[model samples]
Target chain A: DTAVSQTPKYLVTQMGNDKSIKCEQNLGHDTMYWYKQDSKKFLKIMFSYNNKELIINETVPNRFSPKSPDKAHLNLHINSLELGDSAVYFCASSQDRQSEQFFGPGTRLTVL
Target chain B: AQSVAQPEDQVNVAEGNPLTVKCTYSVSGNPYLFWYVQYPNRGLQFLLKYITGDNLVKGSYGFEAEFNKSQTSFHLKKPSALVSDSALYFCAVRARYNDYKLSFGAGTTVTVRA
Candidate 1:
């Protein structure tokens, strides 16, 4: 069974277009996070939610918004996407504030 | 700020031989360290972690890591390397009392030759 899964494994879009990526976790974790992996393979945390509440917003662009309707789901919505946004986005979840995180398969977003 | 460093860009080892991927960390207070592996076009898989326990912590796929407080390092090691074990390894660290976010290293590519 997949512990954490992401929908639309591959996303290709044009500049100025809005897009969204969905992530779900079956691990029953309370904390979920969104990370972006650049072409250089550097992973950076963008947002984190605990119990459906925003906890950490790592200075991401205002155009990037993360919504957690429930603890098991965290969706990322990007408004007016830019070419620089082309990268693999990963979703992760942990049991609590301090624990190992399980990651999703990742969504490859391509902004043409 | 907390950070992790993976000195080697890549580590190559022959099958049936022991392998090691070096990882060092920097943090203020107590730290929570972790090791994760990633295959091509996949997500990171949890390997092991060091919260506060024996120096040697073991995890899935016969993987183990040694936590050396004096060195501020948690290196991943395996007794016998397999070709299938080759992947990208990442080291992450987070302050024990800080937020839930983890700071990851640059990642080291492991290639096991058969």
Candidate 2:
């Protein structure tokens, strides 16, 4: 069974299109995170939510917003996507702040 | 600011030989160090972590990491390298007293030759 899963594994859209990527974890974790891996393979934290509460918000652009409906799901919505938004988005979850994080199969976003 | 650095961009080793991937970090308080591996077209997978206690922590697939506090390094090592073990490895860190976000290194690609 997949401990973490992201929907729309592959998303391809034109510039200025709005898109959303969904993430869910089944490991009963309280903290979830969103990460972006650029073309150079540098993984950076975009946002983190603990018990549906915003905990960490990096200097990501306001065009990107994260929403956590519950402790099990954290979804990312992109507004007016641009070519620079093309990269792989990863979803992760952990029991607490100091626990090892479990990552889901990333969603490859391609803004053409 | 908390950050992790992987000095080497790539490491090549022959099968059956020992291998090491270097990682260093800078944090204000006690650091939570972790190692993760990623294959092509896949997300990162947790390998091991050093929270406290022993300096050497063993992890999956016969992987182990040595935590050197003075040196501020947590290097991943394997006694014998396998071809299938080759992949992109990342070292991550998060201050124990800080937020839940983990800062990752630039990643090192390990290529084990048959």
- Model number with the top DockQ: 2
Give stretches of model 2 more than 4 Å off. Answer: none
Q: What is the Cα-based TM-score of model 1? A: 0.98
What TM-scores result for chain A when each predicted structure is judged separately against the true chain A? 0.98, 0.99
Candidate 1 root-mean-square deviation in Å: 0.8
C-alpha TM-scores of all predictions: 0.98, 0.99
What digit string (tens of lDDT, one per residue) describes model 1 on residues B2-91? 999999999999999999999999999889999999999999999999999699999989999999989999999999999999999999
User: Residue-wise lDDT of candidate 2 within B1-110, one digit each (tens)?
Assistant: 89999999999999999999999999998899999999999988999999999999999999999999999999999999999999999999998878687889999999
- lDDT string for model 2 (A60-102, tens) is 9999999999999999999999999999999999998778999
In model 2, which residue pairs have backbone atoms overlapping below 3 Å? none
DockQ of predicted model 2 = 0.88
- Candidate DockQ values, in order, are 0.86, 0.88
